[model samples]
Target: MTVVYKLNVFKDPEQLNQNVFAAQYAVRGPLAVRAEELRAQLKEKPDSLPFTEIINANIGNPHQMGQIPLTFIRQVLALCQYPALIENAEITQKLFPSDAIARAKELLEETGGIGAYSSSQGVPLVRRDVARFIEERDGFPSDPNHIFLTTGATQAVRMMINLLIARPYHGILLPIPQYPLYTASMALYGGRTVPYYLNEETNWSVSVEELQRAYDAGTAEGTEIRAVVFINPGNPTGSCLNEKAIEDILGFAKRNGVIVIADEVYQANVYDLPFVSFKKVLSRLQTENPNDAWDKVSLISIHSVSKGQLGECGQRGGYMEVTNIPEAAFKQIYKLASIDVCPPVAGQFIVDILVRPPKLGDPSHDLYHKQIKDVHEQLFKQCRQLHSALSSMKYVKCQEPRGAMYLHPRIFFPKKLIETAKAQGAEPDELYCMELLESTGICILPGSGFGQKENEFHIRTTFLAQGEEYLKHYVAGHNKIMEKYE
Candidate 1:
């Protein structure tokens, strides 16, 4: 034939946007892919690998690791999905709790039905509940109009990153050993990242001086620092920020005239430290210094039902509350949300349940509280067990997890292992993690995926993996790797 066909759009990787190509999410990066491959292999050929199972410690997915969903939440969700259950008095009385039935009815009435699209911003009643939740948590007033229900905190973060980044040079400050979503968003949106290192020696505490230094350096290099992100009860490190620390950060944002994006999804995941909201601190500052421009500092605080005791990651329910944002900017944010039409309607319903759970004296109250307490206690126990195991390992310095579902332990690799990693064109920690996965079928992430100080090595593992048996396997595998290198 004489005719030739024209190339299709986006025919190759090079034809696509380079920024998307550059973005990396280490939690599900190469190691995770390999883990999946191994899992498939195990399924097809049972005795092919040395280990029988793959313990996924790479991400904070609780239900995947056997954390049971709260009965009350599931019951309410079921009723919302099928209102006929509520209509059937016999079925409702036997199967669903009174509070769950009532909550579902209220949400169904407010939302019309789960099958229909909600307001682009969110369901009105759900937003109000979220506002009330914030007020109860932070001891400050919250506006329902200012709240936007999202698919998860991830969507809220993406929206804010998109808004803050107008041009290529616009910068956002992120913590090193970050959750990787921050850096990935910056890469996708063509935003510059100004990394401020947390003081690892001090249990991953944020430093005002470090913030100032990074700001000055980024500004000197012609990077316009647009916003600062604070992951309270941080993702990888699991360190909670004190109220004073949060206040200092807000003051910093005020001075720089930049926005504050508080990623407080892990707020309820705190273990040792009391969780304090940036909204709380900022509101207090504004009240105390009425003459100051505290009210002018734009802040977006995010929360999700994914991480806390609910462990509803599959539901993808979350909300972000905007404060001190100008009306024009708020409109723009609303426009962006409108373009997406709406978040999952079912997810929106979960947000409602999360904010307004079974109250005291309700039939579901005792069971709900007990389930939450059990989950909390189990997580705490796992955190202690994992931390202690890693701490005992040679050249491993594990921080006691204060909050969140992860433990980011610094590993001092043997010199020989570092050389081997360099030979393989990999970071030492990455090589260690790879070997660990191959040996024990336990998949974890390396510190290099999250930015780290030069010459420092670390690994991020979630304590969410079930049982103590895997911990023993992890320790043995890690020690064998060290001894091999030595």
Candidate 2:
């Protein structure tokens, strides 16, 4: 007897949500996938590729690039994971610092255990600690009730986009060279993307006029513009927004009646300009003009332990603080979070430690400070080295690294390269990145993935990998490609 075969439930791509297919996350896009295949080949044969090892400059992942985890964070996490370790005070004392033990005990009390789920909103104590962290950072009071611990800022962004983009015509203004998360989320949520190009001449400065122009263009196309996203200490561009810039954006949001979604996950990664929280700037504006529309502006500020010195990306620890959000919308946000149960309990513990770390005179203080300082210095040094290398390259103009882990260098491709890429139906930068990867085993993202001006080319690469040795190889590969294309 012959058996009948049935088609899979979502066999046709059209049968599924088209939005899912529309979403493109270039950070882990095609290039990153191919790099993995190369990595596996290298693991088996050790010399299948031209280079020995893959340099993952594609994403801002510090730990993956050999940055050490904070000893204090790991110690506390160890105790939290196995509370029984804390029971044996004698042995625990020898292995763990007094502060780590105490902190772990406190967190365990709040979370019950890393295995058990906390409140959908998050552990109350952890939320409170996050509130305190914000309060201290912004010099303004924060309400724990308004805080929601998320898997990472990524979740918060998705939630906000889902909530705000209720209609197909709804749109969110995004930086042209944005972190792909915003663009991907927008696409997945069925929202229009209003592109506002960052001013590369002035270190990727946010222009109010550009914002208005994008907003007007989106509006003219029948889009209900609901929110604007800002990535402070920018992702690929490495541009830190000043206080005035934040204020101007808030004012724009207020005038246009759109929400402000501030992604400040790299708040601690600043090297040149001082990082300013949107919450802080908004708070001051409200205070200065109590009767103005400032108080009416709704803002969601997000932070994460994934970036900065911690580099705890895998932990999935982050929090979003909502201000001036309507009570009804707030409840809905909570409802959505509850549907997902709770974020990783272990991640919550990391958030707690991030906001409230070892203070002065604590046993873990000196070591924690030392580790942080070393990471900061190393990151700054790497940024400088890469910027210098790019500056000397022909037809490449790179902005100085201000903050963030990655540098996005503008590459003026040769006319021949452009014509060849067009003939093959590809972006010039995409071809450039692929060539660089094949020759050097160095994986980086093409600017097309992050959105760029027409007729322009760029590559976004993180300087997270240690040592200047890889720099020589990267430069050689880049020069080879540039010469070949020329």
Please count the clashing residue pairs in each candidate, in the order shown. 0, 0
- lDDT values, one for every candidate: 0.92, 0.92
Root-mean-square deviation of every model: 1.1, 1.1
Instruction: Report the error of model 1 at residue 482, Å.
Output: 0.4
Regions of model 2 farther than 4 Å from truth: 1-5
Each candidate's TM vs. the true structure? 0.98, 0.98
Q: What TM-score number comes out for model 1?
A: 0.98
Worst 10-residue stretch by lDDT in candidate 2?
Answer: 9-18
Please write out the lDDT profile of model 1 over residues 198-251, one tens digit for every residue: 989999999989999999999999999999998999989999999889889888
Error of 2 at 247 (Å): 1.3
Model 2 lDDT, full chain set: 0.92
- Clashing residue pairs in candidate 2 are none
lDDT of 2 at 342: 92
lDDT of 2 by residue, 1-486 (tens): 999999996778788988999999999999999999999999999967799999999998899999999999999999998999999999999999899999999988876789998999999999999999889988999999999999988889988988888888999999989999999989998989999999998988899999999999999999989899999889889999999889988989999999999999999999977999999999999988999979889999999989999999999989999999888989999999999899999998999989998999999999999999999999999999999988988888999889999999999999998989889998889988998999999999999999999887888999998999999998888899989978
Off by over 4 Å in 1: 1-4
